[model samples]
Target: MATTTNDTTYTESELEAEKTAGSRSALAMARRGAFYLSLGLAAAMTVLFLPDLLALLVMGWTAEAGAELGIHRLHVMGIAAVVGAFLLGLFVQAYKPRERIASMWGAFLVILTASVGTVWFGVGRPEEVLPFLAVTGIALVAHPAGRRLLRRGNSYSPALLGLVAVAAIPILAFAATQLSMSSSTVDPHALDGHYVMMTALLIAPIAYGLFAALGFDGWRLASWFAALPIAYYGLLSIAFPAQVGSTGAMWGVAAICWAIAFVAVAEYSRTETSSMLRREVGHSS
Candidate 1:
């Protein structure tokens, strides 16, 4: 027979181990929650917006037939591209929630930024803003949000930084032009949606690239998320030169070039790092 001298007794290491296990369990659930939430949101957004994309594809830009309709279609396509890029990131996060935590955070940033922009501008209906706010809250509860932002070992490639700088020029120019517009310049009816699109255009690339550059494992994947939306703007401008003007077309071309360069740099860096790691492992053996 054995009896404990104290009613309860536990070593410090045992307590630490138990606490660690609990933390891991919570993180695991959070990751799973992030995955499911991302997937669900992706599916819903796709269903909601895919029709608009398909309509654009099927009807063609010429179908709009009027200045208002044509401009509205452009706005729709711009918004659609942003949403599509966002959904793509969510799908990526859902694929491997643990490994792709950066993308998960990127998803949260998109929603949060959009929510704030819409609310601040008084652009969308209460229903729209509320849903995004709720989603931002739910996403925040998943994992330790923004913990990676505090990591000290994060590194940025000079080449990638250069690309970001170049890309930002046109982005800043476009932002300035949009912001300078008044009710007299742009149709008051379209102002809200236009501002909302501008927010996405301005925020998505910076947000995704910032997180990806902050020591994320899948910088190559993140490059696509950052580059593609900007590429959309370029493509739109080029395809509708009559609408966007010669200067806009030039900017669009520059954007496309930047996207290509950014992806190439990311891919080259990833390949070089992998090759170096294999060489080190081989030498060690």
Candidate 2:
């Protein structure tokens, strides 16, 4: 009778432990899901507003409001709030590497410098449009840094890394070309060709990189998210042919698409890794 009683106790204890483990696993999965969702939302927002953001930056060159107030205090404040919230969400979802954060900050600083340069040199020092060159230069430098931080300790996936590098190069090059030409005396029609060329250059590589990262699931989600910007740019190109002639709008659209694609791929890869870890845990148990 005592042995039977002891057996009963052992069974109950094991059941309790299993239940606790299951609960913890559920919570962890939930957290990961939330993180992916947050990332997706942030990327989507970036895509939706990117055209306007670029427009604002370009207009900052000519608009009195941009020159005097700097990106309109309200827009700047809004972007800040959005970026803060996105970063906070990402932090809550995962323990990101310090290098990844550094890379992100580096990119932000470069972009900010370019925006400020647009306003400062708009009228007074058109030659200073050269400062805008830093945007792509910084991004090119930061991409490797970010990849290094992200891939640290993990077995290197050469194909994936290569894809990312390939996608980024065109973007950086296009941005540099645009910056260089912005200072020249090119006609609007010619400038439009530059914009179209840059956009065309980015589309295939960025899509491929995202596919490698996310696999089919990620590609599907990212593709749906990517469509919005493509449509927006299509309309903008058609409606305001003269105003949207610059490469600025095209680059902005491509950046938005790539950003969303990258985030989607990252989330999918993270989830796959987590799943593998969980399987290892289960096998050990």
Candidate 3:
């Protein structure tokens, strides 16, 4: 009778331990979900602000907003960029960060700094000071939430979801741009420059999706290529500032795409590279 009682007790203890471990894992996953969601929110906001609706409202396809409005638009993009970066930091730092994550941060910081800085300097206004502060404050809140998600393991579901989002936006953007361009009259002379940039934006996401989903070294290289469209499109707005601004009020949407692509690709690259290296090492061992 004592032996049977001890056996039952052992069984219960093992079950209890398993339950505790499961609960901990569930909590970790929940935290990771929240962290990724925050990043998605930041990306969405940046997309909304990209086209400079107010500037487009008054400026009307001039590719440049009137002086005051232009500065205001630039301020919005700057704020979006900061928020995007902060959210990205939270996501990247959440996983088991390593050399790859460091590289990811370095690359993104440089890109965001250079790109967003231009907008900050190019069209900055004193009136936007308060707004910038407010946006920064929001990002500060998101930072901690993301930090809480940090864990020692990795999960592909989050990466997969983020990648899906990264791919879907551009695909939609491509359709929207095409539709807009079809109905709107772009100057014949300017068509050449516009087509080149738009074509890249159209093709990039498809390529990003293809290689990212295919997995392997291809996945590791996805972000580097994913960045191509954003880098291409973002600059075109500045380069042909007159052109994008003139096209429509939706220019800000492209900027949002830029932010999403940047972070998505950076994170994807880091994770994929780490996974590949570990596999390679395991095989070699």
lDDT of each: 0.60, 0.39, 0.40
lDDT of 1 by residue, 39-131 (tens): 676467556636656455325456543344555555556666666666666666545545666565566677676666566665644455446
Give the C-alpha lDDT of model 3: 0.40
Judged by lDDT relative to the true structure, which candidate is superior, 2 or 3? 3
lDDT of 3 by residue, 95-130 (tens): 443322322332233333333332333322223322
**Residue 151 local lDDT, model 3:** 24
Clashes of each: 0, 0, 8
TM-score, every prediction: 0.74, 0.32, 0.31
Cα RMSD to the true fold for all candidates:
5.7, 14.2, 14.4
Please give me the total number of clashing residue pairs in predicted model 1: 0
Model 2: lDDT to the true structure:
0.39
lDDT tens readout by residue for model 2, 28-112: 5664554345445544545664445344433534556445644232223223322332233223222332333333332333334
| TM-score-based ranking | 1, 2, 3
Off by over 4 Å in 3: 1-16, 47-221, 224-285
TM-score computed on alpha carbons, candidate 3 = 0.31
